[model samples]
Target: MKEIFQQYTGFIMLFGLGFFMACKHEIPVQPAPENPSNNNPVDTGQPCDPNTVYFQRDVLPILLSNCTMSGCHNATDREDGVVLDNYANVMATADVRPGNAGGSDLFEVLVEDDKDKRMPYGRNSLTEAQIQIIQTWINQGARNEICGTSTCDTASVTYSAVIKPLVQNNCSGCHNNSLASGGYNFSTHAGLVVAVNNGRLVGAVSHAAGFVPMPQGGKLTDCQVSQIKKWVNFGALNN
Candidate 1:
């Protein structure tokens, strides 16, 4: 991708800022998935685990989702001398200390108790799990490892484990009660159910015609989208 966006973190990175808001006011008619020649899924090897943190799959998403918005850390908007949209930019600007999470400016600010100093600025703090992911990545030497899930097991998808966290990391920034970009609050299960029932959930992610192709600057891997589809097809339960 021309931008700092990655192919794997595409799901998290898909949470583009500004114009690419999730389920915005435009819930157009859901269309069928388009079969573009280059839209094929790529095999990214084994599933990523906490013991190892991949930049593309783990760290970039959080940064892109929360930091690379229009006026924050994008190339156009270097808020506070920090640019986090891409891996190189992050390394060059995010002040990451190779083996020291506490010393790394990027890691330090995430855990800051002061809301004014914490990253993501005005929004809610990232989940503890999210914060820990970054800490681990930094402490592990902040390698730009490309660890992606090659085989997407769409069977038996669960909401709590897979779906909720996915949305939290990828979509909730603009679709929450505070922002409600399109009169939708994806942070809540009720709002998610609404999207599922109206086919917006699947339509948007699948890049089906009539729906906004998301991740704004990036694209989601076929595996991630398939897992979502599997969950919706079976039943978008709160479980």
Candidate 2:
């Protein structure tokens, strides 16, 4: 019986040793999971051409469309004591600081998270391209410099090239299909012809008495006005 007990004890010890060895040697080591955050940093993506972000050419058009339309930030309304009609007024009221887009109040309101506090009020939000152009202009010192060094071509002005772009940039903001302030819609060629024939277009843009100064924010450049006048003299053809 003592010999049998000794044999049983030996068998149990061998089994225990084998189990311990199996646990230690048979387990496979797994690699640590990859960290997703480490893959790529947040990319806002380039909004506008960094080199072509000009205040007058790029930024001014956006402000005119979204900010200085009728009953908003125009000189007539001057809503909330803010007048974004001209570069001087915009610089003073919009709270823009040269070379600091993040710190500028104008840019802040544009990218505001709360819709109530955002700009363009009830109108459609500015596109990412538009917002970035403004931001880039602010970051690049927010100067009143115009884009393109080409000379103004007033002699051979055409509707498609000159008049269309001019009205679209300066007048179409409030006078577009969505807003149609003063019962005017300059979004289409036919719509523009109606304004041209009625003399309201020229009268308003020229800031004549009894007519609301158009663009409401700033006057058209002498060259621009002259070009439009020339186009009108040529019968305002839809060339």
Candidates' RMSD to native: 19.6, 17.4
Off by over 4 Å in 2: 1-65, 69-71, 74-82, 111-114, 127-133, 145-150, 208-210
Q: Which pairs clash inside model 2?
A: 85-217
lDDT of 1 by residue, 1-239 (tens): 64546655665656565346655746754221122122232334656664787776767767776777788888887898898876677777877777788988998888898999997789877779889999988887776665554567777689988888887777776677776766778888889899899888788878999998665444566877988988898888889
Q: What would the TM-scores of all predictions be?
A: 0.75, 0.61
Tens digit per residue, CA lDDT, model 2, 44-86: 2434344856555666766876687657887888989887766
Q: In model 1, which residue pairs have backbone atoms overlapping below 3 Å?
A: 14-215, 24-182, 25-182
lDDT against the true structure, per candidate, is: 0.74, 0.75
Return the TM-score for candidate 1, rounded to 2 decimals.
Answer: 0.75
User: For each predicted model, how many residue pairs clash, with residues at least 3 apart or on different chains?
Assistant: 3, 1
